[model samples]
Target: MGLIDRFQALFRPKDRENEPATVAMPPPRPSSVLARFNVEQGRRATVEEARRMYDEDPRVRGIIQTLARDAVKNGFELVVEGPRAEEAQDVAQAMLERVDFWSRIDDWVRLTLRDGDSFLEVAANRQGDIVEISRKPTLEMYVRTDEFGRFVDPMRAYYWADRLASVSERPPDHAIYFAEWQIVQASWDRDEGSRYGQPLFASARKAYKRMTEGELDIAIRRKTRAGMKYVHSLEDASEADIEAYKQRNQAALNDPFAAVADFFSNKRTTIQAIQGDARLSEIEDVLHHIRTFWMASPVPMSLLGYGQDLNRDVLDEQEKQYRRTLEQVAQWVTGQFVRPLLIRQWLLRGIWPDGLTWSVEWASKEVSTVAVLAEVAKAVVALRATGIVSDETLLRMLSHVMPDFDVKAELARLREGRPDEIWRMAQLAGGQDGAA
Candidate 1:
């Protein structure tokens, strides 16, 4: 029977106990094609080849690293606010520092950016203290499904060479999965439900291949030696003489000095230099491919270390958009991976508090240069001068411009006749003008 017929038979309803008796049927034998399909489809595409190419290809690596670096450039903070808020925050911070969390997160981002999906197997001691967190290659891991074809929590993972490892073992709860992008509603029959991530550069594979081919073509063109066809009258020459001529010609071609010496001796020989085009067009084509790859990337060219001829306004806009993207990534990583890990740690440490709520805060995305801050301060002062904003509103706006601004303290000092430094500066300037 076909695979579909077998599936139907397996899932077909059985006669109820109260219903009429029916003969028990034997399970259908598995089809060879079905077995082969399961075996082949279950295996993920080998990432080593793509990873090797990514490493060797500077352009590819640059794009991937650019995206990854920007995503986690600002790092993140664990904000725990609840009954045990302070303790939770302290514990989380301590654990983060102990594990060098930022460095591990950076590695996770880079791997996911390059390989589509990155895995972190969380290892803990008997006391449930996280001992080590190591990255696992996507090629070595596989998903496991239950009898109902639903994915089993704690999926089966194994090394490619470990044929004896039982496929039925459930992965530990600490195994964290981070993917750059995933397809939704994909077919399970084709293993699309396996949660394997599609690499960002998978779409640009063809362009990369073309680029390599172009490079090879250019190299081959450069290394090729010009050749001249020799025509001689063999009518008067014996076989030995012809053989000797062939050997001499081969030797001369191998050595430029020998070829010049032979030129002086062989008066009957005519030399014609064969020339080829410089193939400068291939270089242009390769550059075009590189540009295409960059354009296809999610990151902007400026972020990938290409800032030539870029407008300041355009770059600022690109940075703003890129920062927003990074913020979203930070949110996703926190929700999907970091939060669970922290919660698990809390549970292990017996610090799991009731009604606990935690959040991850990324660094400010706005440009924080001195010039930018000055501009923001000017805007806030102008708004406050208009008298249209309330004192509370003015303080809130000023707080955004300067996080260290203390509205209540400043107000108390002003009420006590102590002006701010800026006010003192204005007074000094006015007194100097009067004295002059």
Candidate 2:
């Protein structure tokens, strides 16, 4: 049986057509005026609003982009360990390269941060050779749920079967479902038993709004100098003179020949500018709002280049803690993102339980200097001299030090005993594009 057939057989109950949702919103309270007012006006920010913030706000975009990019900055690879491992690993690696896996993964991270949930769709050819990988917009897509509000097998999820309903559809139908074995959801910071993921910046939305409004207020204050006003200084004069002066001042303010217009004012009025001081000199409050917004985001201040006030030691300590956060994201990528694809791809090819095993080994940035890498290379070379472990084993051990280390190519060259081959492979392994 196919994947869908299998799921149907296992989980499809008799009332498939009429399965009542066991979860729903509580009934509205009609008696309380406060409840009615809240129902009418108190709408919360949504996933779409978070996306808008990511696109339009620099601080928000910075927090999300920084976390997403740095988490994958080191790199990652699928390492197959046993029987037929080389062929499987090679196929998977080539598939990833063809689809530009690294760039696509970066996009996935960004979308997940923006939308709180993201999705990926992977497909193979008729011969079960892995071929296609694509990112799906979370807004345009959704998952299926059973009666209990659990995503029906979130790993190999069920797609909404209303089947690409019109965007104009109000309260669209998400009732029917169809199963696809090759799709996966990448969600973080989700509530238990909830169908959707929480966006990274969801909690800080109010702060984001305040910060933007503050910045705008500051700009207006600086540019316009907090509104202009005309103070008519009258000596001991009659009401007629005061009225005439007011008319003349109004004319000057409205005169097209004047340098300042209704909003901008005229110089002939001997004006005392005092129209707007709403926050003319209160810039410090805006700064405070900005700091609050940054503090509310998931990223640390150090990651966002916030080290001016901090000493070297303090910055270094924060850096360490931030690295730990990145490591956690990496682990999630391995399990939630990488492993699902590998397993589903294998299951599609019927290669399960064939004594083959796979592992994910993510790379880290080359913080080690040339001397350190050389020392590692030297140690590896000594281990190779013992003739105990195969060269393939040794290279896999050091693959984390350099991504794209060609294990098979190096093994062939070592067997051939080409004197220059080791140097060439070493250079290539270090991300040298055109090493001689």
Candidate 3:
């Protein structure tokens, strides 16, 4: 097929006439014996509620945003490795600059982290240039899969004042799907063949709620006076008098700007301040819950701005693990999002490099100190001087320390006998030979 034809085929909606028209209904609950309950409806409701909470809940927003930002904070660059690597890299760079690929991916990451799954619809003009890319919420889209659990079609429902007005099938190939985790069932017939993804915070909802409550309790404690027990003699005071006295005391205590005044009373009321040990314990419990949340999430405590007392080695290991996860996400994004868009862009422009294979390289999560970089550079230079490795190898080693360093450009300069300033400085230093 030609480029347009292939693109069309990839996105063509299935014929509605060929298939039985079935109204979309919630899948039956697995717990139901007769399959009367629509558990899928409940799940959809839950996902919707979770989405709402993610938007409204400050703690949820903070946690998810932190994860999303950190995942792509290092950012990513497209790397093409093959005979036409340089040409492909140039194309990738152009595509990035034109489209703001990193920013788009950052947005996608945030959505996926918030919703557990994110869908992007790619629209191209007749010239094959991507005109727009938009995100579709999972709540608005319903995916259908074949008997074998493969995606068949996705339907988008439009709502008018929260009532479904029309349902339209999205062109299959026009959408890119990113799911962090999928819920698969053994009996595909019993469930929606398309996988359902739950957000990372879904399981920790209760813990988060408890932590929030604990924080609120602490705040209330900080603002309010400690509880006091009043011992009043019933012999002299009527119930009405006792009630009035209690109300006055509460009003005085609750008023933020009220000043305390000692009053002499014949009732002989002895007041003692409530101990704050319980409030402190509750605060500790909140911390425990937070730690539990960190354990459940892919993010480490250090990444979320905790773990200040952690040793450097431990923090490094945690960051390494987190970066590894981001790297995997980068790989998945490259395949699911970048590749197809780039291919479409290339076909539109009629520019296809031979043996083109592209991958993504994330910037280093750990910033190397100058001392560390200098020491590593010294070792690499020594190795190069001993003829143990070539200049290309040295450049590759330095690329780890300085990701922006263009190894290919440096190699080309060396081959053409046009050394850069660094090379000239090295030569000059060597010529000095401690003469000064």
Candidate 4:
């Protein structure tokens, strides 16, 4: 048995089991508007002053004008549907036209709902009617039109208003259907940047298929709209379809290989995102440490600029080479995640059944005549065992990760003799990313 095998046989954990690691959840969004209406509906104080401000502010005159035009042009169509349907569609169109009107409404809603009743109780009471109307495509189309019309345009607003109103009035479970349509209407009126917009869009889109086929009821159909908005505002996961994503990502956080893959794969880009999030304070410290060690050091050329070039006077050629090697080693070792893995036997060499086993101890080192010969032997063995070895790959992967070593000739020889080491390096480079 090899030395590593013998050691493993004697000391390996017998059970070979690992406890499940808890996946960390991202922080929740700061606000939720649908949730407010769901719980506090009638109990919350009306923001009458803010509502008045919207109507009176000249900055919003453009929106009021556009909404009034749309409403008047299609007044016969809107009022023919129902009072709530007519009011909701007009309000949505008007609010969408005003600059920053959605932001103002969001702030007002948040303030009003601060001490109101819970949204769950309200949702529970409205569930039955919501399910009833969800099956109708006509109603579903109206919901989408009125919702999207506020921000985009209202070309088909009349048809949608009529469809929604008709569905709401149809069943024994009328209240639930009406409440659900209102929820969707409110969600449509929300600002684009508001937490709920995307998911609501997704929900509305998915429900469209069922509604088209006449399978879903008005109530269940409307849930897709509200649920989607709730999902969008909270997690931003709705950009991808929910059903497909839930199936794919359900065990993503639990799979170790997948976790490690995602970590390194997203290392360069996600590090910046983590730094930007207000929740991740540690990212700043990590960035500071990396910058100090890796890129901020004084250049050797700068020392010579001040005429401090202690040229050949201080050391012989061999001694100068040693200093260069030491500097290379220092540069390679700083701020690396796998420093411990490469530190102990970086310069060691061994003969084994698998060929000559050399430790990846130092990334940068001064070469002696004997050390050079050992490096050549190590390269030959690595090539023979792995079927590939290259100087550039070794320098980037193993040599750089352990400690710096200046082995230019060895690197060149390995490049010509062994090339498969590149693949091995890629496999080994799963999660030891040190970049901040």
- Give the candidate number with the greatest lDDT: 2
What is each predicted model's overall lDDT from 0 to 1?
0.56, 0.64, 0.55, 0.29
- The candidate with the higher lDDT, 1 or 4, is 1
RMSD of candidates 1 onward, in order: 11.6, 8.5, 8.2, 36.8
Q: How far is 226's C-alpha from truth in model 1 (Å)?
A: 9.7
Q: Write the per-residue lDDT of candidate 3 for residues 50-86, one digit (tens) a residue.
A: 6776887665677667666765665555656776567
Query: Tens digit of lDDT per residue, candidate 2, span 346-418?
Result: 6555555246776676776447677767676666656666889766677667766665565556667767886
Q: Find the 10 residues in a row with the least total lDDT in model 4.
A: 115-124
Against the hidden reference, what TM-scores do the models get?
Answer: 0.59, 0.67, 0.67, 0.14
User: Candidate 2 has which clashing residue pairs, if any?
Assistant: none
Model 3, global lDDT: 0.55
Backbone clash tally (model 1)? 0
lDDT of candidate 1 at residue 109, scale 0 to 100: 71
TM-score, cand. 4 vs. native: 0.14
Of 1 and 3, the candidate ranking higher by TM-score:
3
